[model samples]
Target: MTGKMLRGMVITLVLAGGLAACANDPSITDTIDTRSAPDGMKTVGVCYNGNNTTRAAVSEIALKACPKGTTKLKLWDKDHMANACPLTKVNRVVFLCLH
Candidate 1:
């Protein structure tokens, strides 16, 4: 391959990597509801630092720990938990973000 073509590919790869890194970085803001599904369903909200991959892993753990037929689990918020998912024994709960 030509030098110019190789350089272009390298630059593209670098830029793509940087963009992905930026995308993975989570932003924190207080919200009323953190559940991916905002419904009457019992929802557990944890403090998500925008790490979707880790969050999914954590969620896998939660699902095993939680009771059957429970779906709503998310990054935690104290008030939301008290009000929303209190009756949700099946609601998988976790706080303190993990990398």
Candidate 2:
């Protein structure tokens, strides 16, 4: 392929990759924000990139709900009472499913 064509392809690929990354994160946040589990329910976030979950669920829950991808599901953990959920009270469980 010509040099110009190659450069164009590379630029397009880079732009696509960046957009994809952006897309993934926000979706998870949105999901978490708008989620509400049943009364006295706890949820665990399933990591999209790895097997283990994150410990930031506590901080995340504290923040105001926005979207699914905003908080990231894997970062959360199951609990009898929403212990670490940023909110003062967690009456139910809502999974922060992250991509």
Candidate 3:
């Protein structure tokens, strides 16, 4: 290929990669519902913009919602098709807190 064409392709690739790298940078919303389950258990709903959100970020947010005496969190359900959240959050992750 010509030098000009190669340069153009390189520039395009760089820009695309930059945009893709930012896919996981969107804000996430955590909704905690204690009444959803019985005592000693709680449900956490996470709303995210993209599917690229890191697992660590999601786990951190859920753990923060745990009660004062919570020992660990048991993942009761994780439903991607559950559109309980609005905005750009297409997936719904439900974590059940255990004390």
Candidate 2 vs. true structure, TM-score? 0.38
TM-score of every candidate: 0.35, 0.38, 0.53
Higher-lDDT candidate of 1 and 3: 3
lDDT of 1 by residue, 1-99 (tens): 999999999999999999766544322223344444334433333332332436565466445444566555545434423433322221323432331
Q: lDDT of all the models against the reference?
A: 0.44, 0.41, 0.64
Candidate 3, residues 12-84, lDDT tens digits: the string is 9999898765544433344453235666456777655555777677777777766777677776655554555
Q: What is the Å distance of residue 60 in model 1 from its true position?
A: 25
Sort the candidates on lDDT, descending order. 3, 1, 2
**lDDT tens digits, residue span 5-44, model 2:** 9999999999998865543331121225434655643444
The backbone clash count of each candidate, in order, is: 6, 22, 0
Best by lDDT: 3
Which 10 residues in a row give candidate 3 its minimum summed lDDT? 26-35
